[model samples]
Target: MKVHFIAIGGSAMHNLAIALHNKGFEITGSDDEIFEPSKSRLEKYGILPKEWGWYPEKLDTSFDAIILGMHARIDNPELLKAQELGLKIYSYPEYIYEQTKDKTRIVIGGSHGKTTTTSMVMHALKDNNIEFDYMVGAQIEGFETMVKLSQESKIAIFEGDEYLSSPIDRRPKFHLYHPHIALITGIAWDHINVFPTFENYLNQFEIFTQMIQENGSLIYFDEDEHIAKIIKNKREDIEYIPYHSHPFKIVDNCSILKTNKGEIPLEIFGEHNLQNLMGAFHICRKIGLSDESFYQSIQYFSGAAKRLQKLADKNSCTVFQDFAHSPSKLKATTEAVKKQFTNRKLIACMELHTFSSLKKEFLPHYKNTMGSADEAIVYFNPKTIEHKKLEPITKIQVAEAFGGNNVTVYTDSDQVITDLLEHDFNHTNVLLMSSGNFSGLNLIELAEKIVNKY
Candidate 1:
């Protein structure tokens, strides 16, 4: 297969390009800009574009398919050329569906825990020697690429993102993947830029549930009221399996699952994570994995990258960085760290990076989300807001939105670092939560400096 990618520098796009390249497909891609990791990874695969900008002259009917990424604008020249030629053009998710149509698709979808839940299922499948094609959002421990495609694998597991598939394709990414076994971890109103309203944001999941293949299974988290309501009215042809947080107890800072086999200790913790684990368990069971195998494999699962990932620890002070920008994720992550280290003071810092998080109307959703932290800090780069063309937001407005006297807001990344450094690190755990890099601050280095200070 010969495939050309437009805006191939995207995280998922580059990974898919590599996966297809490894499968011996002739891959070519173009992007206006390419950043680290994606740039280097693509170069290593010998599939990096010869130049940065799009070249419409390169587009022709010879290519098997043109995969489009969200980064590409609707007016992208290459996309126009593909359309002009009447060539097959696939949105990232659409192409994935086309490739995995023959396999049993297991899609994990929700506003939160999608990556972690998908990672858990992947780890379990691999540990049990189950060969499966998969596409997860995060770079997991055992996986070389976030996406892997093989003709031999009978199952395809996808981390079902609810975001728009492409600029031209308005459908949510998960909607394209009609999964035979689907799971919705939970839903909290997000992606306000696209959906605009809470009800509209929620309707995507409802559509996702309806998109499941006939007689397929719908696994969901029963604890979430919204998810529970969505599952209340279900199709009799589809199997509905509900899961709650797995029965577990925290023993000396470690969470051990109370399973029928025995008390199985896990490397990862948190109520949300336990719930994700339970969701993964049901998915694995449906895919023919034994309970014993799932338990044994899950014990080795630490977590997906940046999903409450521990960066550094020293002198009773630990530092963690999480990819949590949404209100529900921020709250759950902050509470998890605080719960895990009850003896320590929890200092939680998060960046209002996403379009939703930065919007004035959406800020109020974050009310009391960081209340679990002894000290809460919110950072937002004014330049970022301007770049995104969002309405200006002040530190006071952010503070008021969070509704906490303990919350401190910072506009400067350096100020945040300075403020954090000023604090004594003893008996304190620092949790840096954001979907961004805190405006270019190297978190690993920051974590090391904070840990070494103790």
Candidate 2:
């Protein structure tokens, strides 16, 4: 297949490009600005555009399909050219659906925990010797590429995102999956710029439910009130399986699972992760995996990358970095880390980097979210808001929103780093949480310093 990607340097876009290139498709992509990892990965594939920026002259009827990325604007020159030529254009999600339409698609969708849940399911399947194509949001441990498509695999698992599919396709990416088996972890209002209100954000999931294939199954978290309502009102044709947090006993800083087959120890912890584990277990059940196999395989499952990933550890000091910017993720991650290190001083640092996190209205949802952390630190770059064309937010607003005397807020990146460096690290566990890089901070170096420094 001949495919062209517009604004393809995005993290997801570049990964998809590399996946397709590996699959023996003729791939070409263009972007005005490409950062590390994406730029290097694309270059490694030899499909990286020689020069950045859209080439209207390159778009023609000869291409089999044009894939659109979220980074591309509606007025992008290549997109306009493709439209002018009356060539078929597919949003990244739409194209993925087109490619995997014939397979038994299993889509994992939620306001949070989608990546971790999907990764867990993938790990279980892999360890059980299941062969399948998949797309997960995070760079997992065993998986080299985030996107994988094959003609031989009869099933495809996707980490379904609720965000907009593309600049042209305003629909949530998960809406296009039409999964034979689907999982919804929870419903939390996010993407304020697109959905505007909580109800509006929720309606997308309602629509997603209707899109499930006839006789398909939906595995959802029973603890989520909003999801419970949606599952209750759904048509009886689709099977609804609700799962709660796994029965587990936490003793001696380890989380042990209480299963029908007896106790099974796990590497990951927290009620939220236990909840996600149950959701993944149900999905595995529908796919023909036995309870015993699931448990045996899951014991080896660490976690998805950056979803409370451990960066450094010593006798009394440990550091965790997570890709958790949303309020739901923030609450879950903080609670998880605090629960794990009940005796240690928890220094939780999070960056308000996403569009939703930076919004004024969305700030209120974070109230008391970081209460579990002993020392909560929030960071945001004012220049980021300006670059994204968002309204500016102050440190006081962030501190007040968190509603904790323990919470400290900083706008200056250097000060945040400096404060962390100066803080006593003997018995403290630092949790750095953000979807962004904290304005290009080297997490590994910082983590090593925090763990070894006195």
Separately for all candidates shown, the number of backbone clashes (residues 3 or more apart, or on different chains) is 0, 0
Residue pairs that clash (backbone atoms under 3 angstroms), model 2: none
Sliding window of 10 residues with minimal summed lDDT for model 2: 228-237
- Model 2 score (lDDT): 0.90
Candidate 2 lDDT tens digits, 105-152: 999999999999999999999998998988889899999889998888
Model 1, residue 366: what's the lDDT?
97
What RMSD, rounded to one decimal, does every model reach?
0.8, 1.2
User: Candidate 1 at residue 99, lDDT?
Assistant: 90
Clashing pairs in 1: none
**Cand. 2 TM to true fold:** 0.98
Tens-digit lDDT track of model 1 for 323-388: 999999999999999998889999999999999999998998999999999999999999999999
Where model 2 places Cα greater than 4 Å from the true spot, the runs are: none
Scored by CA lDDT, what does every candidate get?
0.94, 0.90
Using lDDT as the measure, which candidate wins?
A: 1
